[model samples]
Target: MHTAKILIAYDGSDNARRAVSYTAAMVGSGGNRLVDVAAIERPADRDLFADDAAWKAECARRIEAMRTSLNEARAMLVAAGVPEAAVTTRFVESCRSPLREAQECSIGTSIALEILRLAEEGGYDTVVVGRRGVSKQEEFLFGSVSTKIIHAAKGLAVWVVA
Candidate 1:
């Protein structure tokens, strides 16, 4: 069998962690297997953060959070059986508005487009992400990213870890 190239969408949420852990188990410690963990941040509108300084601070905080998420996902993969050398990490940021929210089958799941872009560009065969990355209230209001990803990743395999 060919080695699978997997990309994990990590956000430091418990569900995201579970996604990494699950992928790590599925891929095992094969030398040929390659795992990529990515943390994405869509900068919030400046108007939402009050002042320019506050907006900049928010961006910095989000970047730091993304870095932490990538590190955590990499560590999880290493612990779960994947070789440390086979794991790579990435951080991506985009303006939150341009990406169209998936209104067809999902709610507030606009991030799937970016995930799709990364998966295709990175040559990954599989994309893993959590079922829901936010709190109960947020998820209730915003829906799930997993649903959108499933719809968007036409030919690629997508695993939605609970």
Candidate 2:
């Protein structure tokens, strides 16, 4: 039997938490399976008043907050019968795109690319993600990360939970 490699994209949001729960249910009853939980933190949009130090500090705080959510996701996965060692949690910084460039990309687009990169290199069979995340307003205006991932993650299966 082939062991399943699942990647769950997580952030501190209701949609992300639901993705975790869905992953736990899918893996809990299986044998020889593992799940990789990853969160890509977008940098704070720079401000006129906030200098480099302040921006870095803000990003640090955001990563720290994500750590708490990562812990909760790990705990939930373990409680659902996956071994602690089988759950791997990771964090990455979203790529910084230069401003006023024709090839510029949004943070969400960078994040989706990163997820696909990891999936291909790590040999993950399926990439599971939340359909929508914390910011309903942003999603309403710009669409969600899942949508971007769906379009970019080719030759792989993507399971998105609502």
Candidate 3:
């Protein structure tokens, strides 16, 4: 049987690094697999400011930051023995307004939901994420996005790396 494709949710955390390491080990053993690293970018709140130019500039800066982080994660994955060709990266933007609208329209969509949707749509069989995100809040709560992905991703194994 072919190895399943793995989607690793990376946010430049130590746990994410562990996930990449684990994936590398699996792939090193001749596992037939494709690895995709995804980073979620939260959109800037337009309601917080009235200046359009400032919002645009902030958005651009955030995107660039996300890109840099993703690139670094990709490099780490490659260093861990995963072939560059076998790995892909994705950046998903999650805007609050769109989510609110979706909820109002009875869509009830979220970034976690979108991640699982993308995983399913792309035919990946497994999802990997860190125990915590970049925020590292110590409130003893699972990040909402990771928790949702864990519970809602039917037929797909979810791995939470510490």
For lDDT, the strongest prediction is 2
Q: Model 1, range 25-76, lDDT digits (tens) per residue?
A: 8888755889998766666576886677877777677767778778878888
lDDT of 2 by residue, 10-47 (tens): 87788889999999998895699889998876767767
Stretches of candidate 2 off by over 4 Å are: 94-109, 133-140
- lDDT tens digits, residue span 1-162, model 3: 876799987666677778777777666535668899887666577777688777767767877777787887777777877778888898766554232222222122566777787788888989987666535564244356677777788988898765
| Lowest-sum lDDT 10-residue window in model 2 | 97-106
TM-score of 1: 0.81
* RMSD of every prediction: 5.9, 5.3, 5.1
Q: Estimate each model's TM-score.
A: 0.81, 0.81, 0.76
Which wins on lDDT, candidate 2 or candidate 3?
2
TM-score of 2: 0.81
